[model samples]
Target: MNSLYWGEGGRFGPFDEQEDGWPNAGQVMRYFREKSNLSAETFALLYSKELEKAGKQNKRGQVTATWILNMEKQNLIPLDMERRRIIARLLHIPPVLLGLATLEAVTIQSRKKKPMGTLQKVTIDLAKHQKSIRDALHIHRTSSAKNLMQDVERDIWTLKDIEAQVRGDLLYQIQELLLSNFLLATRIMKDQRNYPAAYRSANEAVRVARQTQDNDLIATALYTRGCIKAEWARRGTVFNGMFQLDTGKMKSAAKDFQGVLQLEQETSIHPQLAGFTRLQLSRALAMLKLGPRDAKVAQALTMVDDAADAIDADPVEDFYIRALITGTLTGLHAGGYHLGRSETLNAAGLPGQALAELNQVRQLRQGKTYSGDETRYQAWFDLLMSETYMNLGDYPEATARAKNALVTFHQIHSPRNMASIKDIQSRLALSSYGTSIDVKELNDMLQEWYKPE
Candidate 1:
């Protein structure tokens, strides 16, 4: 077990010996080739073709079989982030799998300070607008969603103006719109259960980002796309096989995460956002059952841990981010424990710990008299606690938690949420564990409003 920090200069023998260490590009290349049923030569040719398709390579100069062999040897670690990203994308793998060094660790030979260019100045301005938009769309906003949406529309136009001075300004404008749409649409889609529309908006966001030629934008868009894709994948795609577990869409999601890995040098955005994106990628891989272990999982997990640690690093500066990151990591730990990531149920020690965090979230909400969506967030936490209990097979406790969610949903007039409670109730019924309320009472409630009039 060795340890290394991103800023500790050059390579470190590693982190904890238990840490999965660096992922070998050779292993990922081999996995994709075998899974696609292509021989070594054929795989390289196909992958090289794919890179060309993405406009990442000079079509006149083809990658040779010998060159592919050298990469597979795993001796030459990729020093260039761009090359690493291209390889990860071509191989249908996560970029974090490539093990590139961090920008924070890059030491400058001279101390000449370059003035912030127009592009940098414009980007900083865009970031300010982004922050303002985010603040306006705060979950605790007192204004109606319609009023908030009007403000969002105004900001979108403002984003277009700020982005207009840059090269490929139209594309940047579209990317900004897509980014805002991605966040708003995905949040609506998730809460409303409009998975198809959500996927469309998220994919559109990625498409716009790709057209913008900015790695940071591309990475952020991909990260957003990956999050939506993961949620959809877990629900399964009964209609379109294109979105199935093994399809390119999953790989696309992975590649987008890799995009983030590749653009590490251009991370002018907040470190907290970058870290959160990495976490989103980790969750995507987990849903795909392509965890960061075996040969290619280390990079993925490293990104996840580093991102969380980065948030933890500035406790005072990133207080909200730290709390959110801790809550997210705790949830992931509990999820992995339940989903067979480890054999020992209690080994993760996170099931109870996550509940404590949720309690904290609830207390934080209480401090400010939450209304509307904020109140729903509190109810959402309650529902998650119930689901966790169910995952732990604590039937009585799960029933109680679900009941609480049911009461809250009805009070809020949320039919969709009430339906989710019914779904949970159905699961409880399958186990033959009766709720504290009469079965007839529950049925009557479901039948009265949920049934079509």
Candidate 2:
């Protein structure tokens, strides 16, 4: 065996004697390309002409592939915003991922001591961008929302350098901008399933909002944090079979929701916001796994009814708000209220009434335009239908609905719902065949769906 030097004082013989050092951007690019089984020549051939047509040709008229080699070897590093943007687009990654400033950041950096009037204009523009981002989210255009948030993040970072130079209303404007950025970042992070990052961003939003003493902004931040906690708690539950609650996490989530409600009561902002908060609190309470007769469950149902009436009376006209209310109502009818009623009826030997309540949820879901809400609503609807059919002894329909729910859950990237559907399928199989079915194959499939990137 040949010896080669590895890290400090570590060696294998001659074969391993190749140089070891930190790879530059170019080297990293080459390494990744080669690892992907792409030859430099082939990679160049693929993108060179496009780069040339895009006018990214170097002084020697070499294309982007040549530039990549130059970048790898530390001979050239593109600093122009256009070049960086082109490269990032070609690579399908952010410019920051390539250790380059985004175009927005670069533009902001080029400005020196921007006038307050200009900043005010910028603030207004940023607010408009935020609204656009919200619109994207409303339409379930997650990638667009994320890209907009990233732009906002870059602009905020660029402004931070000049924070001390600004004063008075300008400083306040800057603070509000920072607050919005953090809050938006929190939302995008949560959507992407990066819960920890979302929580951190929400906390930052709260800190900044508190500095401004803005009750609305603070409430928004608190509401966001509370939602994150509730989701985390929900994910912690053993979702297979019946919903087995994780009491500790559920309690923590309940406390977060209660805190938000308390803040709202103290400050008294938008009545709709209060309704929204109460809706979430109701959801948390409903999912506590208490029996139907539990006072808490009844209270949760009351909260849901109250929130729904409030939301309907005010009419927010926001897609997400409407979807959320619809979703919550579906949940309340399917499991929170109706499911509890069904369980109680089943326990009382009244299977027919139990099935009727479950069917009511299906009726409610019908004739509603799901649109962008398809994945979520479909999963819930199908799962509830499956359970209802099973209770009614309609095994075939139960099996089909369970499978459909599984597929919908997969589409939505919901491991918990997938697990629940699998459980239901297993129960259906056992009921029909007098033997439990093996779910090893389904488990393997779900493992692939949830595998860490």
Candidate 3:
């Protein structure tokens, strides 16, 4: 029952404990091979061939079997990130193994820094754009998303120009600048329901974060990526009228969310990031389209409960996060406990109690002036409420809410949600309510709104 985790703690049970208080990378490699019953010779040969096939050329020329044995015999840690990766991939070492960085880390390092970040050293002017990139993110609902994205993109280009001429810690600040701008771009794209563009922006944010090798920033990047993917999977997919989960994409999003949690266990994660990530992970797991009694459903419920508990215990007084994934999470979620009952019940296809949960949330929010975050939630709540009514075959209520959600999503330039509203239209189209005048009118409105430009 000894702890296996490292905070440079006492030696964990059954692990190869090095005197230097870190896992010996060389022994770890051997550990994986021996676990697989792979002899040194066979393991080395396989490693060599894999490297050759991948066209890897190390400083020691061709990696040989004898070289591998010698390294193991001497407990020589392979400082070369690539060689270690080839070994890890070939042998399938567990994560947290020393000498192994994520496969993404290698790609981030090898990819040349974008020339945009470089200045002709002599022309370096940090003052020109230093504050500009940071200011770009000071955005609110008053700004147009498209125009905001364009401005941010320009700011990113300028920041890159500033980055090229700096060295030392200014470079790190620029990296954060790049990460922040890219994340903002991802959000703007997702806000517009432009998932592909969001994906690209998220990818860049991850690369920059990895290049910095900062765990908290990396967690943030992964969280943002997971959220975008979740939205893309649920909203951007074409309507099949079945309301079936996009299992593959959903699972991918879950993996990304899970990766952030793994990083959390290994290192300190920002409280806000940790809280929001768990919320997103819970939504993904709950909606895995599994049976009610399935393991994922239980796991999903547990995650949300943990999130609520953490919020109550946390001391951070007044920061908020507007969380949305496939329109599953509500705004006003992060700094507080969002009752997961409604979300889970809705995902489980139990609309009755789910609607009640929504009513409860409404009561809690009843007297407050609708803040911007609440305004966002109101639009999404309209969609969720619409779906719940449709599930209960209450078309009039569903249509009214769907129409309301559609107008809000459209007004906010959220084409993704607007398009998802069609799923309601689709379900109603096949129902006995298919020929109702209100249904036809709703259909016509969607057609007109989504028509042409």
In order, how many clashes per candidate? 6, 9, 3
Lowest summed lDDT window (length 10), candidate 2: 9-18
* TM-score (C-alpha, index-matched) for candidate 2: 0.53
Residue-wise C-alpha lDDT for candidate 1, range 1-453, written one tens digit per residue: 111221111111112111234434465455555656666677668757766776767444777667677766654534556766766665554444455431222221222333321011111233455554456445422222333545655665555553443333323443555466455545455444456776776676666666766555566566666766655554434322112343455556667666665666655543544655566565455444443244234444444455543442323233223222221211222222222221111112335544544454444432232334455655755677776676577777777777677676666555445656666566666665655454445545666655311
For model 3, state the Cα shift of residue 134 in Å: 7.0
Among these predicted structures, which one has the highest lDDT? 3
Per-residue lDDT tens digits for candidate 2, residues 230-325, read 765654344334344466766776786687678767875455556666767776776663566667666765775565444334444654333222
Worst 10 residues of 1 by lDDT: 116-125
Clashes of 3: 3
The deviation in Å at residue 225 for candidate 3 is 0.7
Q: What TM-score would you give candidate 1 relative to the actual structure?
A: 0.48
Tens digits of lDDT, candidate 3, 43-104: 76787687777777555776667787778767885676676777877877644465333211
* TM-scores for all predictions: 0.48, 0.53, 0.63
